[model samples]
Target: LTVSVVVAAKRENITHHQHANVGDLSSAHGFHTTTSTSYYVTFLVESGDRIELCVSGTEYGMLVEGDTGRLTFQGTRYLSFERI
Candidate 1:
């Protein structure tokens, strides 16, 4: 599905976690760290409705705030965006 929209905003979320490595009992190797990043975009549709969708990192990079485009999505999943 596609909708004509204006890019309202963009945001990124990052998370980190520490895990204990039980096998390697040494203090230096006792723990490991992991990081995760997520991206989201908000759009203003022709009907004056606002919708926010989670997008991929690459997709996030291509989107610019205030730009008008056609947003393609499936259900709540973001597919692609094309500038008008």
Candidate 2:
């Protein structure tokens, strides 16, 4: 599916997790950290409706706010955006 829309906004969400291990007196202690990131884009359609969709890092990088384009998708999945 495709729709004509204007790029409204973009956002990124990141989450971090930390793990710690404690050993006996003969051993050592250590800490490990992990992070996860997600990207999303918001579009304004001709009907004046705004829709937010989760996108990949590459897709997010290619989109710019206030850009007008054609958004191609399958259901809630994001495919690509072609600037008009």
Candidate 3:
């Protein structure tokens, strides 16, 4: 199954930000430089866009192949992992 979400206007505040670990990486490059802490990106869906995704869509793919959840955007862009 497919899910479609509609976002409302003037609700951009609903968008949010998040971070993730990016593993170890050298930055200094000065003799014995220490590893630096890196962060990845995450999403905070808010409004203005439509999101059509399956509920079973995550990292491990779809569980039942037809389960979906629609998260209507109000003022931000809709972003998420695909189901299949």
Each candidate structure's TM-score, on Cα atoms with residue i matched to residue i, is 0.88, 0.83, 0.19
Q: Write the per-residue lDDT of candidate 1 for residues 1-84, one digit (tens) a residue.
A: 899999999999999988778677565677888999999999999999998999989989988999998998898889889999
Q: Which has the greatest TM-score?
A: 1
Residue 57 local lDDT, model 3: 20
Q: How many pairs collide in each candidate, listed in order? A: 0, 0, 11
Question: Once superposed on the true structure, which residue ranges of model 2 sit more than 4 Å away at CA?
Answer: 21-28
Q: What TM-score, to 2 decimals, does candidate 1 have?
A: 0.88
Query: Residue by residue across 1-84, what tens digits does model 3's lDDT show?
Result: 223422221111123433332442543332332343322222223343333332222422322323333433333333343432
Ranking, TM-score, top scorer first: 1, 2, 3
Q: For model 2, how does the per-residue alpha-carbon lDDT over 1-84 read when each residue is reduced to its tens digit?
A: 899999999999999987675554433576668899999999998999888999989989989999999989887788889999
- Per-residue lDDT, model 3, residue 49, is 35
The C-alpha local distance difference test score for the whole of candidate 1 amounts to: 0.91
lDDT of each: 0.91, 0.89, 0.30
TM-score of 3: 0.19
Which is superior by TM-score, 1 or 2? 1
